[model samples]
Target: MIHANRWYAAATAAEISTQPTEHVICGRPLVLYRAASSGKLVALENRCPHRQAPLSMGTVVGDDIMCIYHGWVMNGAGQCVHVPHQDSVAPSVRVDAYPAVQKWGLVWLWIGDADKVDETLIPDMPWTEDANQSSVFIRFHVGANYQLMADNLLDVSHSDFLHASTFGSHAGRKAETEHVKAELDAWSEDGAVYGLRTLRDVVLSPMAAAWAGTDKPVTRTHKTCWTPPNNINIELIMENDENKVTIHHDHLMTPENETSCHYFLIWTRDFSVHSGYPTDEDVRREQSTVIGTEDISMVEAQQRNKIQFGDPADIPGAADKIVVAVHKRIAELQNEDQGLSAT
Candidate 1:
């Protein structure tokens, strides 16, 4: 089910260009491109009203897109402005035009009432815009439900095993896992779910150790917030007596269909922006490997099992607190959209 009246990350700013790019959100196929004249972002229903041709296959003409099937040209507002060898077109001959904007290095599209378009609803990721931060942005098409991807992120316990070689501390994996389990706290408030996990005197992984400038055990803190429509922000800090490093993780999941999703992430860190340890390329390579292989691999497998056996009634555990809270919030939003009382 899709939530209404919300902003979803359609694509990264760099992803949209003069060439029409197709992206699916909540099963709605959208064609995104920059206006040839203004260079502004434009989003329109991908399907043409005539013959149901995909607008993404068309070429951008001025501020409009011309359908290659019939030469029917549609403007940025999805209005049929020109028809080859024909007179004026009917007002009814148009597609839906969504409100789109570029912010925090991503393209955000409003999926609800145009009158209620609010840019503030977009989740904040200041680290992506900050000049002094080293950031890497990556997008993945996951063959899994968006909820499953969100579940993987909200439940931090998986890193102990799934990402043992990357994010997990090899020397102290067992102790750190136990520490996170015992100290984790999760709750929902003000239409958002939050998780706070603090691991004291925890051994850091190799990459994290390098950034923290220490191989000794340090105090690691994780603060995660999940907003509606699958947007998560994680603030992670690892500190020792001598050095501390902070990393902001922005995870955005938008449904391509009922069973597939587009996962976008931006990892920004305060260290190594100007000098010293790890370079930007190093950070990018590490994060790309970790998220692409470890996280996506597990979720895709879970999705496959879900398709074959259907959803199972499983017992909830302590690590499920944040995931549970997020599920509740999503239900509440869906209820609100349907004019039903929230459970």
Candidate 2:
């Protein structure tokens, strides 16, 4: 289920311009644009009240959007400002407006109660603003429940099998795949859930070794933290006798519906800012390939199976501890929203 009180990423800041962009979050169609006058970001219901045509198809005029279908103009506040061949527009004629803001290079919106709009709820990705680091932002549309995608990120054990050819190549050297699953730690605190894994003296995948500028075995520490409403940040630290490197992966998921979601990912690294083996484009391409092809492909199939079987009573493995905790945390949040005790 979708939580109303949390902020969800609607689009990247670069995606919103004078030209309207459309996105669906929490099953609500929204049109996002920047005002020509004040350059402020605005989010409105995609549908126009006059003809039910998509407002995103219209043009931005000053701090307002004019519906192209019938020349109905709506102010940034969603109030009807003007109408063709009419002196004044009806006060009751208006569309829904959602609070939108740009934070950490993303356009975030609040689709719930006006009184509950909280900017502080937006998580911080300080690496995005750091000048010394290299950061790449990528997004995709996943054909699965947002929870399924969350499950994928919370449980990294699948990396050995699903991403063997790419990021998990070195981790899958053994047949049983028990080495990578060792030292798993899961916990919940302060409205968030977390998972940590530490691998010592392990061979890095080709891509990761190239990033580290070394192919030698290294101690790798991986941690995943999940905030409410499907925001995850993964911090990876790799160290050896020569050098140490750190990378931060920030992932945000917003529900388009029960069966689909929009995934936003930002990959930031403290190393490789200047001359490096993996250029920014290289990092982007590799990350896009692993996530778009490997992770998303698996989740979509999982969604299809879930639809066919309704719900399966499969046995849970040891690596599923974090995934289970995250599921329970989400249920608790939903219960709190509904004024019911968590079961």
TM-score to true structure, per model: 0.93, 0.95
Distance from true location, Cα of 133 in model 2, Å: 1.0
Over 4 Å off in model 1, which ranges? 170-181, 339-343
Clashing residue pairs, candidate 2?
none
lDDT of 1 at 226: 95
Every candidate's lDDT: 0.84, 0.85
- What is the clash count for each candidate, in the order shown? 0, 0
Residue range 199-304, candidate 1, lDDT tens digits? 7877766767887888888888889999977899989898988888899999999888878888998989998888876787887788888888889988999888
lDDT of 2 by residue, 176-196 (tens): 543543578889999888899
Clash total of candidate 1: 0
On TM-score, the leading prediction is: 2
Index of the highest-lDDT prediction? 2
Query: What local lDDT does model 1 show for residue 121?
Result: 90
Colliding residue pairs in candidate 1: none
